[model samples]
Target: MHRVIISGIGAEIPEPVITNEELVASFNSWVDTENARRADTGEPLLQKSDSDFIVHASGVKSRHVIEREGILDPTRMSPRIPARPDDALSLEAEFGIASARKALAHAGVDGSDIDLVICSASHHQRPYPAIAIEMQEALGTKGAGFDMGLGCSSAAAALHVAVNLVRAGAHKRVLVSTPEIITGHLNFRDRQTHFIFGDASVAMVVEGLAQGEKRPGRFEVLDTRTWTQMSNNIRTNLGYYTRTAQEDPYMINLEGNLIKQVGNKVFKEVTVAGQKFIVEFLAEHGLTPGGIRRFWLHQANARMNAMILKLSFGHDVDHDRAPMVLE
Candidate 1:
């Protein structure tokens, strides 16, 4: 098997930041003040203390969109959301392709040399050809293009697939882009998770273990693993969409307890998870995190991240300004 290393990483974040105030206003106008207020109010299931709330729980404070130049009415999004899912795919495609092209340039790889294309994200749904097909056309990838969906774990999972493809003699060079446009799907009316996310596309270039294909200075993947159990089975709660699957708004839902309620139990599994998998994967490959310059725990937002960081690194490591949000 060829050892793979991340050759380059690039991301595109749209310039838009729709705040909570704007969303509440739109909801008020659409559903009347008295009715909307009654609907949103209840026992605050989140944040026992302000400290418990994730900095960006909603997965949005602001996000990028073509016509989102100023304050926006949630109900009256411009260009009019198409009735079909495919149209939204293309809309997302525009953002994905632009970000991918930028990623190729950033990685210093000519599009023609890309042996495989992997496009992944947690938001958006399409009815026809695969989303990756659209991305392939955009990036001019003549090798292969496929869409891989794995929830928020999509990016890391893409890396695993890309590496395997190279090892299997499928593709030597791989380009993977994770463009998450959660705004269309997110439910900002729920204040808890509304603060958690930002829509952005992060891309990466990886190469097969070849003597000649080496970036001058690159951080190689020392080890990796997945706590498969962490993948939620049935998404009963959501911040990605609001209202029922029937409600017209069709926004995302953020169930804060998805992490909060299960926080303690999961931490027990995670405590030795890194050390366990790291030891095994490294022992098998002859490597270790200690040998690497840094380690990242694919975490997003603030609160749960704070808790996880505290459990994993303790007071010794200060994740106060880590690039975790970009993960």
Candidate 2:
């Protein structure tokens, strides 16, 4: 078996940005319109969203999105990404490739050096013709490519697989590409989830290391493990069947199918489970939370991460100890 190291990392954040004020204005406009329409129906008026509430709730001041015009348009609450021709490079593959190229450049290798490519993301534009395979061809990479998703853990899961493959001497180098255009699946009309997600793509190069060989500025893979338990607190029912379920197959339903979540449950459950997992994992390596130099926890929620770190370390952690990329 060989040792594996993360030789390089790269990311592509979209150009367009949406601040909480802009998001709230759009949401509240929709709420007002809906409330006006339901005035005589005896239905309760929809509550207006506030930028301050968004910040206090999720700690997100702003977010980068792949598109701006559509989402900001008070009439429409979704991003307007034009569908590309099948023959042309797809958006997901394009975004993944852009990040992958930077990762390859950082690793001092070409796309051809990557024997395997795994495109893992929270959302995939299509089910077939795997985005990874499309990226492989576009990058002129050899060997095999595929796509996989495990919700928010997709990128980490792909990295775990790449590390194991390199450790087993199956491949010299593997690329894990995550192009999450999650804003597309976001329900901008929903006050609870409107300001939560942003679009970004990231890539990492996992390579094998030989004995007596060393690479500076690279992280050595110590150990990798995953724990999973079924929960529906966070979910999205938008899928192929969504179109089929509609009375008109051509008509799309944007109400309940998009992303929705029980934020309180997720925050509580993840914090408890995440802290226990971190403590146990560190203990297995004869280490403690305080012994670690840095912690790169998920960027889902700032408060949840703080609570998890606090629970694991038995005290509140500093911002420098666990930097956040959510905003």
Candidate 3:
């Protein structure tokens, strides 16, 4: 059996920053307009959103976006990314390549060194051709590549796959990249979730180590576990097969595909499942909560993460021990 280790990591964040104040203002204006329209139809008015309320609810003070102009626009409250030509590189592939290059550079290796590439994310730019292959071409890697989508757990799932590939001797070096442009899927006009997502790309380099071969400062891959249960609390209903009976079924609409979640259900389900996984993982490895130095959780919600950490560790973990990037 071989050991797998993380050799390098890289991240890329889009330049545009949308602060909570800006987001709240835009959402509130939309809400006011919506409420006025609803009043005309005898429908209930929508509640106005506030920056303070957003921060308190999600602990997200700001988020980075790939397109700032369109998202901030009062009318078009969504990302304004145009479709690319077939010959052009896809946005997700471009971001993935950039991050992979940095990871390769950090590891002092070129594209030729990688034996596999895995592009994983919550959202993908296209439904075909696989962004992983596109990134492999852009990075000039000879290795094979594929794409994986596992919702918010995609990155962890990709890491698990890479480590297993290395441990199985099927690959020597693997690059796992997550180019998440989640803002595109957000219904910016909806106050409940408009402030929750951002655009960014992250990449990790995993390599197998043989006996007597050591790479200093590399983090070992201990073990990974994933669980799946049937739940519609968090889901998106967007795909080619989906159809609406409306006349303008092909018209662009956010209501059908945008992320929708039952907040309370998701909070409870995720926390319980996450806590169980942690307890089992640590126990199987003969480790305790105090043995871990840092816990970098998914950057989803501050409250959810804090509670999950608290439940798993049997106490409240300080900010330093469990840092968050959701903000």
Error of 2 at 137 (Å): 0.3
User: What is candidate 2's local distance difference test score?
Assistant: 0.91
lDDT for each residue of candidate 2 in 1-327, tens digit (9 for 90 to 100):
998999989999899999999998888888888998899798988889898898888889999999988998889888999988999999999999989999999999998888999999989999989999999999989999999999999999999999999999889999999999998899888888888889999999999999989999899999999899999999998888988988898988777888899999999899999999999999999999999999999887798899999998888998899999866
Could you tell me every candidate's TM-score relative to the true structure?
A: 0.70, 0.98, 0.96
Give the range where candidate 1 is weakest over 10 consecutive residues by summed lDDT.
43-52
Candidate numbers sorted by TM-score from highest down: 2, 3, 1
Please give, for residues 167-239, the per-residue lDDT of candidate 3 as tens digits. 9999999999999999888888776778888999999999988888888988988787777888998888876
- For this target, which candidate reaches the highest lDDT against the unseen true structure? 2
CA lDDT of each prediction against the hidden true structure: 0.59, 0.91, 0.87
Quote the positional error of residue 63 for candidate 1 in Å: 5.2
For each of the candidates, give the backbone clash count: 29, 0, 0
Shift of residue 160 alpha carbon in model 1, Å: 1.1
Candidate 1: C-alpha lDDT: 0.59
Candidate 1 residue lDDT tens string, 209-310? 575675667766644555565534223254344355535655433434232223334445544564465456656776654443455655553444455444
Q: Provide the lDDT at 178 for model 1.
A: 87
| Candidate 3 residue-wise lDDT at 107 | 86
